[model samples]
Target: MTIQENRERPERSGGEQSAAEPSPPDAGGSPAIAVEGLRKQFGSGPEAVTAVEDVSFSVERGSVVGLLGPNGAGKTTTIKSILGMVLSDEGSVRIHGIDVYDEPRRAYAHVDAMLEGARNDYWRLTVRENLRYFSTIGGVDPDSIADRHERLLDKLDLADAADQPVRSLSRGMKQKVSLASVLASEADVVFLDEPTLGLDVESSLTLRRELRRIVAERNLTVVVSSHDMDVIEDICDRVVIMNEGRVIADDSVENLLHGFDARGYRVTSADLDETVVADLRDRFEVTEIERSGDRTRVEVATDSDGFYALTAFLRSRDVTLDAVETVDWDLEDVFVELTRREER
Candidate 1:
């Protein structure tokens, strides 16, 4: 379900686009986006606010990197600086090896942004009008990109709403239009900030799946920033976690989850004996013990690697093996663990 469908907007088929226009990522060594020592602050004196400090990261071409953080984490500020919407007090931002500060026009030529989503569009204009208008303003001849514009409307399921006034459509529908404009653009890199903010569950999931599909099919480099962890986990190949205007963690989702996993578990068995229980407590960090009708459950703080040791201990006392499983952590859990306050 796309924004149009979510809002019950009409549908219409658009002209087919040529497959030759937008090229895939080049096989070069330079990253699609590079930010080093990015620093930004607002105002001065004792009350000056630091929005981004010491943020640095590089995004590989054809990769989706998620920028995550709690409120005031500098996620938006970092993105704005990269897009040149905000000036950084220090550090450098390079888009496809072109320094934005040195060559704003050339660097921004390869980039397109969908910040603030639907709010970026002109509410009075029809969906098609907005697309063509942006196509003309973004340094591309509207006539030359007509096929591409039509294809975006069709691809994003916005064709039906193409002639509908943006003000009459739902907010989500308008956001779809904004995304369609960026996707149809011939730009090399796209920055999406909270693309799924107002979307429903099914629509959000649908958008996420479509985004992943588009990135794979187009081999486009995308930087997605959102508070939706599920969207990030589902769409991003790597994540750059931030907290309090600084990057707290940067790595692949799998690696972060692995690093934060505690390997805790609970085991229930009916044939337990006091001797074996004592041995189990002595051998492992048993956190809790519970007893029910002819059954006992033991919670152990150990990884799957120690399951064998636990089994051996139980077997030595003639206890039957029941079950063993490794604990798992989702992206949200890892985010909380890394971003939470630390104690001495």
Candidate 2:
């Protein structure tokens, strides 16, 4: 099929990527989503609240980038500005290299958003109906996306509830429906805000796995915003961390962990004596220590060389190391540490 032909054209449902349009055609290899010097204030005069400030970042094509920050950190505001849902007083926002500020229709055509608050779906409509409705509004012909719709419904485990009213569904089911609706839009880039919020442990894990599957299979780029660091770490290729309305740290998740986790170590062995434990406390920052039966486990924060010194110290005290391993930082640790430094 010609690349120029709309994948949404329903007559040709035989392709692998019909569940969604192929990733947006490259615009001279430009960034998929781009924002620069974005500034937004909520009100006029001295009482105004600055929601975003000097924020800038770019997401390359076919990459899932996490947009993270603490509460009131301007994450939401920055996202809204980029989507053109809220106007910014300054800066440029682009989607697929098309300026969202100046051409919303053209830019948004390549985008899909699965947001919270039930605002993105019709409560009264059945799951399948809502998918079709969203696709229609998104400029997709229903016939064109029928197969893709079925594929998404099956992938999201919504096939059984395809005809059930969203209003009657559980919160988790409704959230899944919202995701299906976005995927049915056949857009290359999707913005998901708090996709795993309020889910049970199993549901969260299921959703995360399904999301990764969809993004990978469809070759889509996703910008996910969520407080669930597990979801971010599991699915995101890179992260753009925010603080006080500014881009604080932007890097790959591996690099972030490597930088912060370099100081972490875990030592496990049997019969750690009081003297050695005391020396450990005095020499390094110990976060965890447990002793049960003959086994003792100590987790500490120290530099790369600090572990060598730690092992030497233990040996000096007749403590034989059974197992020593590097402890990696979870995304939460990296998030907190980076934002903390920004605050300080």
Candidate 3:
């Protein structure tokens, strides 16, 4: 389907039948963030560039929703507009039913965000000091600050580095600190942009695990923007994919996979001939056919019944089939196919 077509469909109600039913509010569980017909433009007159166009989606309270797209697809612009960093020319943004533009303070009162490359500390301050300072500014009680600090430091695996200065920490370490500050606030909703960018594999895994734990334990709403499909698939319950300033797809991971409905099979045989290849192609979409010396490899797209038919055909022809197995497609494959269809 086209990008416009996909956006026109109703957002999934997270297995709910009615929009009015009492449920957990936002993406996670509560209704934390609701956006409708949001639009933003960068310049005026002939130089104007449209950043986002008619984007609409709701994030439940306490769920992790992923914003995914290629570069220049307006993911960042949508995020900034919601955070009041960039103003939207048209449309509405609501945080827990409070309109952001109408009541910025009240709307963002329970929200905390970690923007991409956001610097959150004084260079000379120690890690513990930075958390303490943020807590003070955030109006966290003095009595609870120490307890919160120790919990975050330990949870983020930053306890050992708590005494070190912010400027002396590695990039991953800095990111962990920034995340700690956000969590320490115990904000109802959290926006994280590229949280695992530039981290090594181990650090990325660690961060993902911590994020999962935080969301599950605290029931906090989370809206995350990232190009990392694995992160999205792993951490987010649903994903909203955008391209050219418009939402292309918004569905659970399973539904998105179901949409493709393409199944593949790999077949290996000996002494395969042109007639056999032609016959298989007539029955199924041939994805690949490779012949190395005497052994041949054949890959085809077919559902269960078609697969059975192909096997029966080969047996009827007395073809020596060595092996057969189903081929599984990942989220990346579905993403490319859907996006390419939209582009066309």
Candidate 4:
């Protein structure tokens, strides 16, 4: 579809809206990363294990895309293939229009990765020493290296620990240092594999914020492989969920949440009878019913119009609902619903 056409479409439930409109190509400005019909299989003959199958997607420039899946779902394999660490049996991966297999050096020129425990600095070196070492290796100009070191140290809140050895740093600090190394390289595309794996709540939040900022300010394309639903929902503009080496869902987080179309209402009343419960169940997915003393609490799922119908049904039966509270859907619910559907 054309860019203008894509921009005018109204949002809709399910994949109908998004799948119908594939993103337009960048034309002269190629996408930061693109994978087409990517397939990977380990070993040969009957003993082979297919790790990735027919995966196709593109990361828009400056966009933060989340790569999500359950354990052993080929996320790592796909990432490794993109980085040219592993060769795909079929399909192609391009970084800034340079085919990874055809020209590994050129394709990797725009790419930088920080897989879990990625060693970008020496443990025995001081933080300042590590920065200087990476800067020189990355070929930063002498004047610019000094400027970048000061900026990175201050921005990542590592100035206080600048003189400490890398081994003495906390997990969060190390993560920050790793991220700083990537930023220091001035690469256009970055892959962060479980960036917040061992971080505490506050550290995770900080890392996520920094990632978003870097992507926005630098116009950097980033692929974050993470299991944290909250992190994906908060930072990602879109997500690609894979299962058993195949992509099951590829859409914006908003679209995923809306696709489920499951909304709930909590109703409190003096008492409820079996007949009333049966009547409500006929029209809605009754998730829960709790009773305590004189009050009865019922949780029912219904769409906007269905909710109105439910209220009318209750009124007709002379059941006075003391309070009705609406509950909005969230990413966790959407994730569970989609993953469950895929399983079946």
Identify the leading candidate in terms of lDDT: 2
Task: Name the TM-score of candidate 1.
Answer: 0.76
lDDT of 3 by residue, 283-332 (tens): 77899999998888999888777888888888987888888887866677
Instruction: Give model 3's TM-score versus the native structure.
Output: 0.79
Question: How many clashes in each structure?
Answer: 3, 1, 20, 0
* Predicted candidate 4 versus true structure: per-residue lDDT over 1-344, tens digit per residue: 00011322311101111212222234478888889999999999999999999999999899989998888789989988887667789999977787767866555644667776455456677887766655454344435657766777787788899899878998888777776666665566788888777777887787777777778888888899887889989999999988889888889988887775547788999857878888888877999999888888899887777888888888888998889998777766776666778899
- Clashing pairs for model 4 are none
Residue 182 in model 4: shift from native, Å?
1.8
The per-model lDDT (C-alpha) reads 0.76, 0.79, 0.76, 0.75
Give model 4's clash tally. Answer: 0
Give each model a TM-score: 0.76, 0.86, 0.79, 0.79
- Badly placed stretches (over 4 Å) of model 1 are 1-28, 141-151, 266-322, 341-344
Better of 3 and 4 by lDDT: 3
Local distance difference test, candidate 1 = 0.76
Model 4, residue 248: displacement in angstroms? 1.3
Q: How much lDDT does candidate 4 score?
A: 0.75
Q: Which stretches of candidate 2 lie over 4 Å from their true place?
A: 1-26
Which tens-of-lDDT digit does each residue in 9-112 have in candidate 2? 22111112333443344679899988889999998899999988899889987789999999999988887777666789999988788887676656666677
**Residue 97 CA displacement from its true place in model 2, Å:** 2.0
Candidate 4 regions off by >4 Å? 1-27, 142-148, 268-298, 301-319
